[model samples]
Target: MSLRKRLIACLDMTDGRVVKGTRFADLVDAGDPVGLCLRYAADGADEIVILDIGATVDARPALLALISRAAAVLDIPLAVGGGVRSYDDAAAFLDAGADKVSINSAALADPALVSRIAQRLGSQSVVVAVDAAAHEGSWRVRSVAGTLETGRDAVAWASEAVERGAGEILLTSIDRDGTRSGYDLQLTRAVADAVRVPVIASGGAGSAADVIAVLREGGASAALLASLLHFGMVRLPELKARLAESGVEVRRPLPAPRPEEVAAWRG
Candidate 1:
């Protein structure tokens, strides 16, 4: 049997506040990152990924103190990114509270960094985030919060990153991000098939069916939920229930409330 598909909650933070926007622009505040992280964990998210979306653009380190605080409260796995540029940075994230550290432009600039981080922290601790957008008829990788295209094929880069010791691929669709249309299934399938490691598909998750399509038809190992979660469009447990009904294996679902409990709660 294959590993169960994971449902991950994504929190994109900027200047200490969680934000969401279409195509990574026109941002609006969502909520407190750490508070939201705790909520998702309690609501049965398989994992929680908190990214400092502005850290790289601002040329500053991740808010380690905030990450540590989030990590301290969570029982599930935590993956963090943004402004992580070196092995030292990666190690620092792990030391602070992240179970895994995500690297974007840094890994693209120096693929060797993946190997070094893996060599020390193990491949399981390394997550290579590939932000891709539609170009012509194929997908190309983007950097710096989807502001610049690298001209590298997203599928090819995912493969290379895995070869360099990236244990997992955090593939996000820049075009579909916050659009709520659906995931870019083609790009997701291409990278998922090209990379041997588990691929977590991000961006464009509007409904449970969208998640089902990405995880099933798209061959993604995990489905990343952002706006759907942050904006209260879909609660994590309810979404997981829908996925379970759709026959996509998830970590677990919230136990059903007893009849008596339900009755008492209804009072």
Candidate 2:
């Protein structure tokens, strides 16, 4: 983990609209995908991630227009995921204007794809997403949007993915997703310690303290937030201020957002 922490806003999309769910169920529309992303970037998000949550299950690729439109205006990096099954798939995503392509189900099924994309596009452009769920007593890797268990240990799989050329790990805890309690510190620290690449901890960010806990005690390089930021419960600038106040090294948060901007959209 780096001394300087990163704050990322993730827009989980399905059917062109940004959506969020409790533990990936009973999804509700968050906002317009492109519009929300623009707001997050302008509000001081370090990176904006647009994930096509339904692509894999639908046997389709991520929406290109959404990525292109959002990427066109943002200066910050944009990473996208879902339905990336091959090198060509990833390359097409980059062509659509994404800074990085994240692969979850595909990576687990064919680990070689990670190396293939890394070999041609460079590891820094590849993000391997690991979604894990707590089993009887340990964490197991889940695939297809955390719906199916692959019987693989989360920590070990993360290590293999990194060795195979993944530049970073986007780790999401299925149990904690949308709970708004906090990130799974034990799961995060275990994977962070096992892998050499930076781990972007995802799920259950309800407050600034939760963010601080993951970056510090959880040993994550970055915190990936969705519901909290999407719903306006925690503004990015204020969150960064709280982080800095707690002694976590972070970029000075941008000034408070205008009233009109906040009224325009929560995401």
Each prediction's whole-model lDDT (CA): 0.86, 0.87
lDDT score for residue 204 of model 1: 91
CA displacement after TM-score superposition, residue 123 of candidate 1 (Å): 0.6
Question: Which parts of model 1 have CA positions greater than 4 angstroms off?
Answer: 20-30, 56-62, 254-267
Which residue pairs in candidate 2 collide?
Answer: none
Query: Which ten-residue region of model 2 has the weakest summed lDDT?
Result: 21-30
- Model 1, 160-232: lDDT tens digits are 9999899999999999987899999999999988989999999998888899999999999999888787667
Question: Each candidate's root-mean-square deviation in Å?
Answer: 6.4, 7.1
**Model 1 lowest lDDT segment of ten:** 21-30
User: Local error of candidate 2 at 236, Å?
Assistant: 0.8
TM-score of each: 0.87, 0.87
Off by over 4 Å in 2: 1-3, 20-30, 56-62, 254-267
> What is candidate 2's lDDT per residue for 60-128, written digit by digit as tens?
433887777888888889999988889988998899899999999999999999999999999999999
